[model samples]
Target chain A: MNDLPHGLLTPQILVELDVLERNIERVARTVSAKGLALRPHAKTHKMHEIAGRQLEAGAVGLTVATIGEALTFALHGVGDLFVAYPLWISDAQAKRIRELLSYVKLSLGTDSIAAVQQLARQLADKKDKLGLMIEIDSGHHRSGVLPDEALDVARAAREAGLNVIGIFTFPGHSYAPGKPQEVTDQEQHALGEAARLLRADGFELKRISGGSTPTAELADNSLLTEVRPGVYVFGDAQQFELGRCQWENIALSVASTVISRHEGDAQNPRRIVLDAGSKILGSDRPGWATGFGRILENPDARISAISEHHATVLWPEGQPLPAYGEQLRVIPNHVCVAVNLVDQVSVVRDGEVIEHWDVAARGLNF
Target chain B: MNDLPHGLLTPQILVELDVLERNIERVARTVSAKGLALRPHAKTHKMHEIAGRQLEAGAVGLTVATIGEALTFALHGVGDLFVAYPLWISDAQAKRIRELLSYVKLSLGTDSIAAVQQLARQLADKKDKLGLMIEIDSGHHRSGVLPDEALDVARAAREAGLNVIGIFTFPGHSYAPGKPQEVTDQEQHALGEAARLLRADGFELKRISGGSTPTAELADNSLLTEVRPGVYVFGDAQQFELGRCQWENIALSVASTVISRHEGDAQNPRRIVLDAGSKILGSDRPGWATGFGRILENPDARISAISEHHATVLWPEGQPLPAYGEQLRVIPNHVCVAVNLVDQVSVVRDGEVIEHWDVAARGLNF
Candidate 1:
């Protein structure tokens, strides 16, 4: 049992420093071995301390989901940052982007001609300071243009006096069961096709970024120059259930005390309520997820349901039910969303809290 | 179209003041007419401004889900407060609860003997000032004990020298389709049975509380002394889909700009990506929810998928897709979770940003 800090609040986020350091080292080592620049997505941990550690472990830059996040890291003295989402910049964002460029080497992703035009109109004076990456649709179909259409976006970006640096795609579909390798193949093909088209059109594709947590290790180094994988640093239940990572790799968990418990009859099963719920753990259960989340100590137990402040964990039958007030560690379904839900996390080593890291960029999704 | 403020950030929460006031007024008026006290659940909005408005409209107190939340409101001068969840108080919480009781008329819910004993042990000196409400299991089996078991808990509270105030239950099952009325009936019966048992056992049942957003209006005035409904002030997509409220009733929405849009092929449907994803809109789709959430203007449209920073809105087939960079209001699946995700909300009046309210109690689920 982890000895939580005395008077530690329930539903508090606990980052296991040893496990976190190992996870970061392993990913950094693997990416270095493959000769791919690692831009660990700061959106997962959203902590300056973690970002500093990633940079120390040889990360090229930090990948973020929003310009607000980029600015946060830039202000915190992180020199290189990439806002990896297709941002539809407002006048405020355009100004912020300009301000960010003055301090850090910043790049942004663009998927449409309209966005490129808007960016040019908003930041016309600072066009040379901005670097754009044309987003390719690979197979996720969430954002990004089709691989064939990447050239049009690149041409528009160049014509509008914006620097088109490269192409990128997020194989988000890799999150599904047994689909990482297949998604990585699609990612490589998409990047390869986009790069070829852009290159044929006299565009020097300096960067070809692709990868989510599931496909990060399987990234084709020959085709992709960089990879942006967020959730690997703090492996979540979704990653664990998808067989992408093991329980030992999960570096972050919610320290929640059991508040209520019930032994069911014929129709129902034994259950316990944890102080941790969607408010802290977040409510991001993918369709393929086993349950709401996983109880770290009891792999067989499932977090059956969650409300704002109550996670109803279905205790595995015959396993001793944890006594009321006993604290347990719960791995959330999606670490990125979970991390965004908190303001700070307890950095613990050997079951003792050593420091607290502010989730400085949390809720900065502008 | 609502004329938003210039340079307004995407995925920013915008709470319509007119609609919010109306929603609050309507609920307070209804509960007043029904001769029941209204304790608006502050967990939904977590704003002192909104809580102040609710109190001005005639709320007996504010209902909170955690001691942290209660403390937030109590410190903000919300004189009467109740932490309505079955809290397993720690030493820190007990100390905080005692501090809370020193200023506010604070009450807490208990369902188990262990929790009651823990409370007694921790707050022995403050027993006279502390109020305990035994939570009765209505139809929602999430928390609370069986209605018949209320007497035992009340006895335990009395034995512990704690002030037993009443009994309460959350008819959470009302959130489903065709379940509100039935669940309200169950709530009445449960409260009535529990009150009867406690009164027969010489326990004074001064405050019988029950009601969620779906069953708030239908609450039996003779049975429930007070109704605690959190979501009525900001009707969500879930409430609308469940036929609990109309589109006009929704007061809170995420102001998100369209970042990317694509015309679908044979395999997929056309979609637009909104900057408001789970991080801002929240990922709380109940089993019966129509989609992730509903768009205010485009009611037919569905938020088909969401990542941490992108809400993939599947636009209606014939509806003209929103232009790139156009801002739209995206109602979250659950308003409470969405409110908790942000630090502040832009309070809009007559389509103009008037003020910003801090989400003071947000993420205060300790």
Candidate 2:
């Protein structure tokens, strides 16, 4: 309990180092025991310090969502990198990719035949090896080539003199409650089929990667050589709702204060407004989420509405409510997006301050 | 033109000095011509540099949504400040409030009896001078005391020794297309009824404030003495959809390059992909917005989807599409939120680089 005064946690993200270490250890152990490589996605915790911990915990490498994110990690000495996003390689990006291949091993994802041809043409002069992963559309209809089209894409990449290493898919459908098991099963089946098809076409399928936080536990690592799961290290409202993790297991939270209280009817008070709003706790409410966010200490309270700077929460029944100016902890709907919204996060241990880490990779969306 | 290389706009926000000057002059002229006190909300452009511009444009004071924002502006020498949101006052905040009152004229809003009582008790020593604005629910329905409950809260504040300055409301419903006139009409009616009710109870209603970007143009300044309108300085996708301004009038945009292009199909030969996504351009979609966002220079193109790091766009028919590595400008859906995501914005004029201004108040949401 450092008496650093309240409100010093302005735009702050409090992370319990103990809980974070536990999560990292658990995920790494689970994946390693099952003989699968753990390529923890850097999108969840963008800090190099956290990435170093993951690597120390036996993660084979790190996965990122964009070239910019990969470069951010690489600059901090992260060598083996896999950009999981289906990147559209331009001339400038191709040059950057060639340069990156010189320092570290790079695996890029592609979902289009045109993209595969473009990458091959751009890297014709490069002698360094670059891995290519063909993205398969398992269930999420956002982006990815259909499983039936995987072989054609793989053949095209091979003909273009690019290394067709493996298949990858994001089982984003596993995010919903009670759906993780089924979604994971579907994802495993999709990856297995895609892998077999590539092998039948005389292409070497070196890696088969699939998993999200909700489906990571249920993933069939028997066939997958590597598992990439982000957001599992910092459980959020989404993980809590999916029954993947408990509130106590949550590692990240926004420390906010009750700036105002509205006492309408004693029996059914209207709402308890907090200083933490959409701006602090990102306004990302998945379809099944009960509210914009949840109060860590006050479980029964739900944030009903959020403006740019005000979060209106409805209090629970038969509970002692907080008065104006009281401090509260908030667990956002999506921890990854919420953490990205802030400039810095406080690394806390047993309610005491440890150190402050700047979100160096924040706002690197492009 | 500055002849700067492509992708040289280091900071995201490009604030053209000449265009901003014209926008400020226009808004000030409109307020003066309509006989209303202009208190521009600083939440849109958090930079004190821009706030100073608004003050130089004849703004009576500045309106912020949070105490943190108020403190930030106060540090930058902004004297008169109005925390427009109905805040919850705490002990820690009370001390800050007292310190702020010594330097600037401070006015805060309250929509509930409990909040009013808390604020009154907190300001017991300085209640004689601190101004209080009763937030009236004027069709927005987010947070504000109902028109009927305004007098009760006002009575509580007065009894507790706080000075009741006036009432205020936000006509957020005016953001609809071609509905500004109707929304402002409702706003004026609500202000009139709330003012009359407070006056009947022997409370002096010194100021009646209302107006947002959409309703500002149609606001009837007869009843209200002051207006608070943010987002007028930088036109966004919402303003474009509401027919308030043309695409060319948009002062802010995200500069990105075509990192990938798919020319496989002639019918949709030009599928341009950008590096900017939800993190750069906010994921906010107004009900009437056609797509996630619009492409600058190419109005026919629409941003089809946004993943964490990729922006997929479908190019228009019969147009010369940008090749890979060609830079393009994107006008985001919501300029205010997008600006908050970055640390700095580039100030440009006539395609020439002017300067980079820090978003000093970016994360001051708390």
Interface RMSD of each: 1.4, 4.5
RMSD of 2: 4.2
Most lDDT-accurate candidate: 1
User: Candidate 1: which pairs clash?
Assistant: none
What's the interface RMS deviation of candidate 1?
Answer: 1.4
Which numbered prediction scores highest in TM-score against the true structure? Answer: 1
DockQ: which candidate is best? 1
Q: Please list the C-alpha lDDT of all candidates, in the order they appear.
A: 0.88, 0.79
B-chain TM-scores per prediction: 0.97, 0.95
TM-score of each: 0.98, 0.87
lDDT of 2 at A188: 81
Q: Which stretches of candidate 1 lie over 4 Å from their true place?
A: A1-7, B1-7
Write the residue-wise lDDT of candidate 1 on A1-366 in tens digits.
356556677989999998899999999999999999999999898899999999999999999988888888999899988888888878788777888888999889999999999999998888888889989998888999988888889999989999999988988888899998888888888889989889999998888998899999988589899999889999999999889998889999999988888887674457899989899989988888889999988889998889888889988878888998998899999999898898999999877899999999988877
